[model samples]
Target: LNIAALLHDVGKIGVYDSSLRKTTRLSNEEILQLKEHPTIGAGIIKRIDFFHDIAPIVRSHHERFDGHGYPDGLANDAIPIESRIICVADAYDAITSKRTYNKPLSPLKAVEEIERNSGTQFDPEVVSALRNALEPNDLPTVQLNEDDFEEFEIPNECDPDYL
Candidate 1:
């Protein structure tokens, strides 16, 4: 699960930097292109014999509990449990972490947002687990400035030498 979580966005290496770095709203085309990261990441992970088993989990992390997400729209039990857990974690991090497009949200607000989307954008069970794990004072607090955000090139193609 740890490996899957760490490498879940590895497919983003194939995404155009312009799309990723855009501060304004993404156009429909850019949004479509960005959505392909999971599949791309899964393909790259599958090439490694050790990570083959977790490729499906990586591929399904974006899947919604209500079968509305891509690349495959898997729902409920059809989606891997590990993927479901990662989905909630990923959303939490994305919400709380500063991004070029948006300001960071408070952990409380982030959790509220996640709670509001429960059973649709996320699995209810996973959301429940997250709620149980978090305590008001235990939430992570990391301060990051603009300097913490750096743009580095990720190889467009998978190379064993780089790995």
Candidate 2:
């Protein structure tokens, strides 16, 4: 289950469009196709068989805390904790990552956004774990521009939003 959430995005390897990985805004149609990566990941995992439990976690990674999420609008505890954990983890990864639409914010900044949306886009408890995971060692110096090198850094203390 843990590994599934960690690697659920592996199917993204198949997307040919660099735009799929761009940090810029996506059009509605592009967003639609982009969302399919979860289902595509499920498909890929299904053929592999051993990862059956991961398929749904992959499929529901974007589901909302208030039943407003995609593929399915499952609300409340209808979502598995395993899935919810990934939802928070995946979001944290993207915000901290250098994508085409945005540069990585400070970890404090990312947690601020997550804490701001906790009861809405994210689970409050899961949000805590998200912030907790930032132990001076997890920040990735990922190449956002795909050219500029990353300066590896992590912050101490939780953003007030988490408090």
Index of the highest-lDDT prediction: 1
lDDT comparing candidate 1 with the true structure: 0.92
Q: Which regions of candidate 2 are displaced past 4 Å?
A: 13-18, 133-163
Worst 10 residues of 2 by lDDT: 139-148
For 113-134, candidate 2 gives per-residue lDDT tens digits of 8889898878889998777777
Against the unseen true structure, what C-alpha lDDT does each candidate score? 0.92, 0.75
The TM-score that candidate 2 achieves is 0.75
Which residue runs of candidate 1 sit more than 4 Å off their true CA positions? 137-163
